[model samples]
Target: SVNSIRRTSPTGGTSGLCFKKLNITTSSYRIIINRLDRKVTVNYRPARLPFSRHSLYVEDTGSMYLIHTPGGVSMQWYHSTGIMVLQYITRYNASVPTRGLCGCCDGNPEDDLKLPNGTVVREVGDMMLFLQAWRVHTTDETEHTRRVGDNCTTGDCSTCLSMLRQRAFTPCHSKVPPEQFCDIMWAGDLHYKDHQCDFLAAYVAVCYTHQVCISWRRHNFCPLRCPPGKEYQPCVSTCTSRTCLNREYYEETTCSFIREECVCRSGTILHRADSPYCVTEDRCVCTDNEGNPRAPGEVWNGSARSCCLYKCMENGSVVAVEPDCNSVPTPLCEREGEYVLDVLEEGACCPKKICECNMTICDSEAPPCDNGNRLVIGYSALSCCPEYRCECDPMACPPVSAPDCREDQFLVEVRGQKSCCYSYL
Candidate 1:
């Protein structure tokens, strides 16, 4: 849905969008459209700016490509027509089938209206009731909602019938009915020619994939204006770069989809997908790792494990050197007498954020030994400081001897002291 689907702002128009699948809101994203300049902004997930097809690991936010497995799903959004295309790039598997707004994608349309609890709506009259289940309840404030018997008529689009039924579209008439497409374009936005053209272009693109080319645009109606040196084509590759970041060359035969786009003319090329202007091969620009176009004298070192910081040179090449630990800044820690060093990864030359103890910090001073007892110093896991204990030492005892032993009789000790012996019996 294009408006707020969150509970806090049902009609507040705050959140960008919410996609619900089987009674579950997949993700919440906000889209801000600038009325003054007709620009669009997406906040928070995937990307804020325009981007080409990329792996969607987060599965959160607006029209985007998503793939859990290899070639699972591909989504494309044409902002001009407000059309979003979700396709299954992966081969259909009997073990894993999708069931939702797209229907049970198992080659059957009968079970397409199955509810979240696995109940199918079998009655034709209940189709409206089934559709109401997926209603998000967002309406354009600029227009009035038409009731069943209201005299709400969209302008006269009777003139579009002949064009839709033209001989050029005969091959695609059965697959895509002309009356349906014509009426939808009129009902959607009758006054806006671009909207009508955008609406028609969708059907034309579908026909092109079926090996039919549509020449529906008129010279004065929705005529496409391309950049200088570029021409509009009925069919082009879907693997084209949308942003100025990626600069890889692709084989035209390996395109995933054949659609319409503006292509550069001969002798001119785009440095990256998002380049606004066409230039000669030598005049192409360069981009950094973050998808930002960079000029000469800029530096980039966005790679995590790389130990070198690169500088963009005038020749369009980034120069780098394998810097040692001296190039990287050392971290400052609290207190004195502590040191810091890098605990690098197995094959990485860069430093990690781990800290190790270089010196032991003891707490209290040890007391003097007394009574032939010695103080023992030991370490324990509970603390980094040394622990003190008192224990008896045999060598630390006072010297003991008898004064004299009389004849055969041994000397008898007075009291507990051995040195107190005076006379023996």
Candidate 2:
């Protein structure tokens, strides 16, 4: 039988030797046979047909071995690659139906089809997919046992040597330097003091988780702690201390946030005298220095009697003159005394002579005064006193002839001539 062929060396002139064969019954085998002509033949048999064509090569240079089974099964392994071994099959039914070797374990195939040494191998058409999903497990079953579970350990596994040999993976701590820890802590403390302490606590917790180390240079956790020279006062509207800022220490005080003060300007008097400060009505009454009451037209001065007088006109004239002396006075003399006496003596008095008694007097002693008349006192007048001559008569008379004069006839002589006078006695 091809399985029972004894180990025999080929007979040839060059240093030939005979070898005995041992019986080994395994489903798969690899044999090397030598012939007399110094020819060497190697044969391989797989327990199940159609094994993966890919194989793992353990040479210095990295290479992948491929095994292709007749039934479309495939297996792959790497020599010095982090992944130690891998086995897979294309058909669901086949020889040792196990997953590929675990990278977290030695070279043993995983018992469960689903999980292989914590590595998951999936079967594809005529191929198997290998990935690093395995974890190491050490238990009593095999002191260094490999299991397929979620919480498998990779501590002492040879296949996990790569992971163990490399340094641990940590986040970038250089960006947030150690020197900035004080500042970060101070800010957090201030925030906590002013706002919610929980927020600051959460922030500190996150920083610690990220490996940020904080130092305690100050006595208190907050930056605003009472120092040697300074005292801790609750933060009021005016917070001057630096430590209080760190701890976010604050004190509430009464604040006139919405209240405002009202004041009057200089030279202004407050209308409301009772209230000294101006609130609602801030009126200012302008006044002079004197306390006297000022009239509408009057201006008050600094002195008590110092008042300005205003002049007003009445009927377009000044009001300074007395009212009784406004008109002219009567003359002193009663009547025209001497002037009237002088006028009566002179005949220059008209037809009516001025009487000594202030009345006009007629001259009756002379013949009744006629149009033409001359007067002789005693002799010239025969019939009637002086003016009895016809020619001297004041009235014009006709000449008396002898026959007409016999009734009353008289003769009179006057001025060296005889004259006839006629009288109607």
Candidate 3:
């Protein structure tokens, strides 16, 4: 069964992101988005060599936009083709799947993320800045197009293509020849066929599984999903082997049947801080020579006061910002007096009411007594409040004597008016 999920930001603005399976399904790609820092990292690894070149594409209809890469996020094979990372800073929130052609080129052998003014990005930082500037440019361009009443044609549009081409840049890592590491990265081992480990160490550093390996040949490469502050240690056998990943020689644990288990990555044990940083992918602390943690946003010359620290209030609780400030702070809803019902999961689309009052009951009680009936008040769990019912009282009202009236007919006062009705006949 093929499963796919698309997410949109309900808080309005263009802050939504989505994930989908591309045409090249054999290769695996992971998209990590940091909405706060406006950075998006796309990691791709092909099952085989000579992977197709794919560029990041976006289709921005007035409603939404999309991110597409023709082949995959892996930009290997060709020097100019491999650009797997993209980061953008935007004034307005970035939404996707809008109705316009806004994607990067994948098949172009000479492809490079550049700007219209011929600015080239040589490093990751430059790439981030370029993408941020591109977003502003495209947003302005889109607004202008909207004002002119021009229908934006989506899917392989010139505007998108131009932006993609202009904003193209060569990744810093492309300079490294894949031959030095390609075989180890893609060994095309058949043993891992049944296993679901994207099997590419490029994306996952280490993996552990319930099934143990038999002599390293029949290893069950189980993918490990680490919690915050931790990362996997890709289990590599020998350095000369085709799958070497430069992992540290940490003590291995014994799983079921005395099988070896890969150790999780960890940072140096800090003196004062008990919970030291878990050295993992996407995490590298800007530390001082003394091994003290330093803020990435702040410059450390000699003192700690210069360290940039974020003081944020999230959900009425003050907490330090995420490591490296690569994440957006979740908004907090003040809980004045009312009791809190439930908080939506972190990064959820809709704003969950942090606090809410008890269920309100109807002010007017007694169901109007009808047909010489008396009102009975009761509580209901379904309604979470009190409810009313009418019980018959034959002596309360006189019987209705009208043409074609049943012998059991009685006059019931409804809304202060007498009405003829059968009395339980």
Among the numbered candidates, top TM-score falls to 1
Summarize candidate 1's per-residue lDDT along 1-425 as a digit string, tens digits.
33322222222322212222111122343444321122344453334334222332322111122223222545544322223456675464444576656677777888899877788989765655565675556443122122221111444556566656767678888777777766655444433232345446667767765656566555565555565756665555454443223334443332444555556666765554333455555444555665545667766565676544666677778677553556666666443334575677754666765444454554556877766678898766544456687766757666666566657767664333322222222
Location of the lowest summed lDDT over 10 successive residues in candidate 3: 74-83
RMSD of each candidate relative to the true structure: 18.7, 59.4, 25.8
Model 1 sits at a Cα RMSD from the real structure of 18.7
lDDT of 2 by residue, 313-409 (tens): 3222212222232232333322222112223122211222231321123122444434344455543211222223324552444444343345478
Q: What is the lDDT of residue 407 in candidate 2?
A: 48
Off by over 4 Å in 1: 1-72, 76-83, 123-125, 135-160, 167-195, 225-231, 241-249, 274-277, 288-312, 317-425
- Per-residue lDDT tens digits for candidate 3, residues 1-425, read 11123233232223211223222222454543322222334463222211223444432111111333433332111001011222232321133211112233433323355655655555644544555555523111222111111222311223222221221111212332233222332233222222222222222211112222222212233333333443433232311110111123333333211112232344322121112233432123344454444433443333243333342232222234433432434444343223545554444433344445354424545557765677777665434345677776656767645455467875453433353344331
**Estimated TM-score per prediction?**
0.46, 0.15, 0.18
Each prediction's Cα lDDT score?
0.50, 0.27, 0.32
Best by lDDT: 1
